[model samples]
Target: MVDLELGTLPKGRGPQLSYRLDRAVLGGGRDLKVPGSNTILDVAGLGDGVLATTLTADGSGELLKLNSAGAVVRRTPRIYTLVSASDQAAAAYASDAPLVDGQMTYGATLYSERGGSVQSVELPDVRSIKVMAYANGQVYYSASVKGSEKVAKLYSWRPGSSSRLVKTVPAPLAISPDGKLASSLPATGSDAGCSTVRGVTTGDRLFQSCEQTIGGFTPDGSVAIGTPANTDGNCAISVAALNVRSGAVIRQWRGCFYRVVAEDNDNLLMVALVSGGGQAPFSKSVLVRCAISTGACERATEITAAKEVDFAR
Candidate 1:
């Protein structure tokens, strides 16, 4: 068993913590203190000892980053609309930009290190935009366009160029590493009424299951994980390993599982919520690392609350 620690805070109120798999401890964190509430949407590490977080403040949301010492490295001013019906906005780093907002707005400025530099990018008139991953001098995202009166079409961004039509994926699109494979959720009325995972390379349909959702793809494009939801809708999470090339389910595991995170050459880190009687606070989140080949999971540590958390090579 890895060293484990546990603590608690009030519901929806807690600090967001960052954990480094290398040290197996809470490396750096930030306390989000509001009058009577706390909301942390997402956290990501920049691989260079820097971390980023998206949070709501005074009803408006902003993105901020912290250094290795947990000091406020930079912060972006409130850019979200308070009256907007949906507060969901996807953010990702692009070049020197620490956070780029990928909403429906056109020519929106992207924020770079310390928010001192900003660059504007053109966007098509799409319903929604989502930044899936950023790496290798490129940023991958999905955009939806209105078509056939009320139909929705999906496209992916090609780095500095305009978006490209990957497929007519309905709503949610999950892109794998290197942006080579994209798996899309099915449309409601289509005959293919099942969740489909597709490969972007050969346009191959990988896996389809009514029970599983493709969480993400492994770094090497060798494997992928499918998360299963529970029928009763409590904390039902299961994982299945897939051979990316053959699209076969080679291994499976179950119980309150989250996506795979902080991967290395030999292991993959995953988080699972411990279910008991009461709903556990987010701060008490538990993380475990497993051998990628064996699926041998071991409790790694309890992540503290912070504004952002990420892994490094």
Candidate 2:
């Protein structure tokens, strides 16, 4: 996975910038630059391949995949409005493909790399599809109704089963591996920086945060990586590992993180921001593997112009 390093553009100049995706071994290896369009948004390990979503200079999204050896395998020909995929399996995306009654009509499509097929799914009354998780045998997603942000809903769909509403949550959310629990990210309000975790079937609040932003959960669903709010615009001061059940801090760190990609046992794959000396344009970023037990970090790769990271586990 690649990481995003914050950069500054000249005043009044919009977001006109170029990005790239670079790959290297977790411990140490020569950086292998992935060849593609410059504006790559996310990269994830998909089975024996790597899948990526890129935002073109024309304001369109394109999905591309590379093999384990970093060779381009497949790429979508048309652009999309939204794209979401997993490293374990295929992806689900939406496009403004047609129009009805002089209104733009949208539909969701599932692209399976393993099966080499594309299937469309119905999302009635849903305005936009934010993120999707394919775990167990179901597809978990979040969406909102047209013209209404407060009606955001979490849903699940299984083969031969209709889509079922799990619960109502905020726009961005996270789901467990078994699709049994759903969590909402911090929204804008009084409890703006706190996340809420709830049971998908019962809608019971399992845990809620007060001072930390829940990044995501581990694969086994036992713990979560959270980042505490920093007053000095530096997030390296307070990173916490929280208990999934009690929302209690199990561990903490002082690494400046742009994102927590994934965790395995006691090692954390994180995109860490290197201090740019309080300069105008903060452009240095590195992919680091941290020992959760000791807070020891080893730089694995130097990513140039990284805008976002997508991890496949």
Candidate 3:
């Protein structure tokens, strides 16, 4: 779950910027007030707890780990952008301009929640990194170079190990859990956002759709959630579940922009933007659980007057 601190302009005139943690399910949940947290960027299950990062309005960021009871167990100094997390550890990128041999370095570092040696990896000529999978001590990230648009690269590296280039997938790559199958948006001249699910190892195309954006891959790597490209223009954006093996659309949901926050073998946790009975700037958000077998959604929680929301799990 993502929490935001609502604050207005005019120098502390309205509500002050604060942060809270909440768990939303089909039935009920409670909000957890975190005293020092102002913004929550991402959260992931790390070992027996949750690992999260905060980016403040003052151009500062911090990585923190909270126990099962929502208490801060460990935290980094400052300026660390948390990237991805596995069961035993977490990875973060140094927000402070990192340089190796007087040249800028672009990569991520691994930190253990249990406290031990830190591992680091470096990639060249890429920025705006997005993590796809972090499991079994390996982290996979995708990014494009400054001027290149034809394809993007996915890199994989374990902690304290040298990085290896995985595959030059199409732009906006989404990989499966086992790192074998992937969905990528082709860089066509006009229909550039149209994506397809393909085999990363076999180079076989599984599925393709026009004007569709990849939401996420299922936990078991058998299905994927694909959303319409223009959610704002369309009255209702269709979120479709595509089977990776047979390249078929299994089920779908009609809603605004949806992000897959967490998933098990049978269900997906989605945060959706529902119309808040206002125009333009006025909007509302809600969290819901969507069943994988059937494309049914049960509203879990509604966020009241939130300006921004982000989730990681």
Candidate 4:
């Protein structure tokens, strides 16, 4: 069995609690005080250190680094709205603050983080950004129209230039690590029988899987989809992995998976709802690391009332 260490932090409180898991025994959760006045929006483990993004109650955000002791090492201002979901290093929303007026004008900012500072690069007019993926320093995103029909578009943004529409996807899109494959869901009006996975490089139709809706892509070009068995009320939820070239369902998991992150080749990290109720004050938010080959899932951690949370690599 793989060892696990689970950590928790209360809402509006800094990172103060940690739980250790060894074998089948779990140690008591402990609190480690840290200085900060922001809510922890996200946390990621990078190398031996930890990177955390926090948003203040005033809508300002910051990215911070911490050592193994839970002490702050560096902190930098991260002022962007609707940050990309795929890769944090590539693209972000145009405005540091949310827009008050309903006019649909916006841009995406691409940046490089060196040492502790971030240098900004600008992209073209793009709004309602959703997911972002990076490969070879290039950024890809799934965005949509701000109002009206609300159609989603897929674009690529490189440094020193504006974004180019790789494809105008009516549904959500996910890009592979090589930036060649784009697996997308079908449009609302299209037949809901199958999902399409397309190759952006050769304009070739790579693969198509039936009875599932494409959700996202893994870094290695593996496509993820939602199956018909998993549903939360009227909201459909399921997870599956598809081979990009063959368009075959290599592995699949049936459950209420709202958000998914491909942690590595053999593992996927997922945030799912508890069975108590579909609405808020949810039973609990669970984090699970599932083995791709065997579909065996081990409960890694849990959170309270977690809604609309995201995980990035």
Candidate 5:
């Protein structure tokens, strides 16, 4: 698996000014830098490459689609949150503060890109949007209203249809393919709480516990991969594959912390952090791929700090 890695050595004029964007193998391979002033903000999988939100030194933000070799093939306008299902389909939603409706609303734009055509709509009520999943032609997101910033609502929108409320949750994360189940956190900026899954319509919780934060669902939607807050006597972290409906752990790993960034049918791509011992902070970060069924791990990138490793989901 190739991971989105921040080049270990500093690039550009200053450390804060910019960083190099690169595609690197799971371990110790040459990092291929993307050509630009790419201070990477976030990225997501788009077909064989990745779509990244980057900031240039002059503060100009760019949305670029880079092929696997880290070369730009296409670029779009700046977007705050982006999600894509394939090269042919993608969505971006952004919000800015400008008073509306008795100062209760914010300025926002929601758009979809298909093939080479783009469709966009302005929203008056949404203060913010976090895209959870995109599929077919629809985009699913969690919205925070302007006044009720503490509250979270799940919504769905297709290019031609109006945005519709799906449900309400504390912090919506991922959704099931059939649009019936959703995973959420108990609260925002959680120090500790349950990573939960509930019915989108019925408001029934399918799984809830501090055991693990639900990372993502399998492509078939039959299994969920979760990462516990910590598994060590002090600092270790682990990943688990669970039966989606039952929350029963089927396969798991211990002794290291993992941030599961992306996955396909058979494996998960993650930034694994391993600590030296009890109560110690993670000493190293490495990109690795783990088999879904066997709990085996393979090296993807060299040992580095968390700031030096990144991946597009």
Candidate 6:
């Protein structure tokens, strides 16, 4: 299950975020508070709970591992960003640039809560870097040249290993839950659709879609969930769940802007902006769920007052 965490930004903007846990199911009907956590940057689910990255009053960062009831069971300090957290560990950076930027060489760190150790390693200097996905406890990150998005090099790292270059995936890459496949969308707003790259470890090309902007993958890694894209020249968007191997759409939904988030098993959790998309206090963040076996979506929960919410797998 993609454990969900909601941040209540009463001001409608950031820097002040509260939370509500257990909303994924069972109503998680209560509010939760992390002592001294002012701003939440990112989160990754660990079973029924989550690993959260928050900023302190002095501008430092830390990671808090909370239980199902939202109580901190463990805290790891000096963590500025929560990149990806899996069953055994979490990958993060020690910098404060929101994320890695060309100007920031803040380096990366691997946190093993079970092993009780942290490993830090240096990474290359890039104009902008984005973590496309995590597979086998290794993070596949996309980096660009100092000033150009022309593509620099792809890098992957696992615990106890240094950051190293790997095959460069297409821009805006999306990897399967198991990290066995990848799909790179065409240029922003382009109609060419996507290119499915099978065997991401070997850089082997697979089938391509005429026009499907894959937002992310389901837990089972069998379906590629499409991001919000225009439908039949309309201003609104359509989200489709496409079969990875055959390029067949299992289900599709049309809406203004629905975002696909992570969840447990093979189900999908989505959020839509009932009002025009914007920061909190200005827009409404609504939650919706889609069952893979039935391709049915559930009614939205309490998101009328959402300021900003974060999700991780």
After superposition, which runs of candidate 3 have C-alpha atoms over 4 Å from their true positions? 1-34, 77-117, 123-126, 144-152, 187-191, 233-236, 277-284, 302-310
Q: What is the lDDT of candidate 2?
A: 0.55
Which lDDT tens digits does candidate 6 get at residues 209-303?
65666667766667777654334532226566777777777777656443565464445666655664655357666666656667655544556
Model 4 scores a C-alpha lDDT of 0.53
Worst 10 residues of 2 by lDDT: 9-18
Tens-place lDDT digits, model 3, residues 123-201: 5555556666765566666665556623667666676777666654656467676566677776556656677778776
1-313: candidate 5 lDDT, tens digit per residue = 1222223312221111111224331221223455564666666654445567767565545677676687888876546577666332454544334445546456567767655567877767776677777765677877777676786778888888788877555578777644566788766665446778777778787777577778677666677878774454533356677787888887776545535643555666665564343324555655556667776666554455444455543
| Best candidate according to lDDT | 5
Candidate 6 segments exceeding 4 Å error: 1-31, 35-37, 46-49, 55-80, 86-114, 124-127, 145-149, 185-195, 229-236, 262-266, 275-277, 280-282
Query: Candidate 6 — which pairs collide?
Result: 1-263, 1-264, 1-265, 2-263, 2-264, 12-280, 12-281, 22-28
Residue 236 in model 5: shift from native, Å?
7.0
Q: C-alpha displacement of 1 in model 3, angstroms?
A: 27
| lDDT at position 3, candidate 6 | 22
Which stretch of 10 consecutive residues in model 4 shows the poorest summed lDDT?
Answer: 19-28
The segments of candidate 2 whose C-alpha lies over 4 angstroms from its true place after superposition are: 1-34, 68-73, 77-87, 96-107, 110-113, 168-172, 185-193, 229-237, 277-282, 293-296, 301-313
Name the better of 3 and 5 by lDDT.
Answer: 5
- Report the lDDT tens digits of candidate 2 across residue range 1-313: 1222223211121111111233421221112345654565555444545556666676556766666676777777433432233335565544333345656544544333334455556665665565456666666767665666464577666645577766445544677655666677644577765688876677677788867766566666777677764426744445677788999877676656656644455656665566552223655665555555665555545444443432332
Candidate 5 achieves a global lDDT of 0.60
Worst 10 residues of 3 by lDDT: 8-17
Residue 283 accuracy (lDDT) in model 4: 44
Measured by TM-score, how close is model 5 to the native structure?
0.72
Tens-place lDDT digits, model 1, residues 1-313: 1222223311221112344422222433422221213344444554323433334555444654554454566666543211000111222432111233643333332222222333335543443344565534344555444453244344444334555665534544466655666666666555343456676656677666655566567766677666663335544355666676565776665555434542543455555555432243443345656555765666555453332233321
Per-candidate TM equals: 0.66, 0.72, 0.71, 0.65, 0.72, 0.69
Q: Clashes in each model (backbone N, CA, C under 3 Å)?
A: 6, 0, 0, 1, 5, 8
